[model samples]
Target: MQAQRKMRIAHYGRKPVKIYGKTTQIDSSLMANTTQEEKRCSFITLNSDPLYVAYHDEEWGVLVHDDKMLFELLVLTSAKVGMDWTSILRKRHDFRAAFARFDTKIVANFTERQIASVATNCNLDLKKV
Candidate 1:
């Protein structure tokens, strides 16, 4: 019988982590003193506002299958064209109130007068509405 050769597995010293869509090596020592929340969040979210960090952790890449939620995401993304995400997140409540809770049927039937009224009441840009 022929003898079988043993296969060896190579081990890398450092751990490779994906940060902001890029893969990079992270030193375990760097996270020694961080809290559980900080350790679990991305690098960009380390020093960000709590609300922004919460969004990153809870909803940034999570899938949405609900119609109302999908509509809300679409509206928020469109509103972010010239604005920052933090601003949009902060005004989420206002958008919901102004857009009829993102009910597709309700928003689809909005008249110019209703749009103008919503814009004025919510202090939103008229053109954006």
Candidate 2:
């Protein structure tokens, strides 16, 4: 006799979705019904992970020359070691709050106590850049 496929349940917002197969928990919002190339460039193949898609489509290789933006990117990139970029993207708001919104001069002149406080609060291993 043949074995029947098992089903799983997952929630999308408040609606319960019946899922099957190894990966069937789909988010309809992210599915635009576009071709693979239309979704992103050839370099990005992490279509299953939304953060990677967002990074590739929205922020990857974009020219950033502003001091504040540059500082923010620097801080985020510093925290990217050992942790995934998805986590970094998720914690971006918290990082800005903790790091004085990445104001270059403010961050540059940060007291050791303040730096220590932010590090402890955010639990981020930041590189000195």
Candidate 3:
């Protein structure tokens, strides 16, 4: 005798979706029918913070061709070691201003006093600075 498998239905704003065992099977047509607001990536959907959502949609995974912008991304990624991306992005403006908009030459010229000032103003970790 074979055991009968139970199926479940889940609602997702537009329609009732069928769930079978451990997997969910969605129709290709259903995906096409979903609105833009309903078609976001899982991470963005999970967080839903406006700034984070915008970053995911606009910046995350996009290639950077500008030298200064690449430097900015490198600095921000380094700063994210012990922190969450949300907090890092929240302070992005402060970081930009403090780091001379991530201009490589200008930042290389920052003196000890300037570094300390930027660190204090941006509340950045000294070791990371």
Candidate 4:
């Protein structure tokens, strides 16, 4: 049997879709008959994963400038050693909260106490890195 296929947009509020098979564009007439509920459900599913879909659509694999931001991404990527990127992405806010907005200077100065605190916070998983 063929594997079940599903597609999702990388970002919320948008419907950039990808198909697993060769079906390119369905007929407009056919789509016209698709229920609004179905369309909405499909869109929601695309953006409903554990991570922020908008970030994938907007940032993943895209070239980033800004040395500070680049450094931040690098740190997070390294922190993701054995974990999924989506998990890290979902906890981005928690990281920012703990690390003081990814300010290199601030993070660099983090005390041992701060490090210990973050290690226990369930919102983020930083032990691997």
Q: What global local distance difference test value does model 4 have?
A: 0.58
User: What would the per-residue lDDT of candidate 4 be over residues 50-91, giving only the tens digit for each residue?
Assistant: 354555445664445687788779777876777777788877
**Pairwise TM-score winner, candidates 3 and 4:** 3
> Best candidate per lDDT, number?
3
Error of 2 at 56 (Å): 1.6
Identify the runs in model 3 with alpha carbons over 4 angstroms from their true place.
1-39
RMSD of each: 12.3, 14.6, 11.1, 8.8
Where in model 2 is the C-alpha error above 4 Å? Answer: 1-36, 42-47, 126-129
Name the Cα RMSD for model 1: 12.3
TM-score of 4: 0.53
lDDT of 1: 0.68
Worst 10 residues of 1 by lDDT: 1-10
Prediction-by-prediction clash tally: 0, 0, 0, 3
Question: Which candidate should be chosen as best, given TM-score against the real structure?
Answer: 3
| Number of clashes found in candidate 4 | 3
For lDDT, candidate 2 versus 4, the one ahead is 2
As for lDDT, the candidate ahead, 3 or 4, is: 3
lDDT of each: 0.68, 0.65, 0.70, 0.58
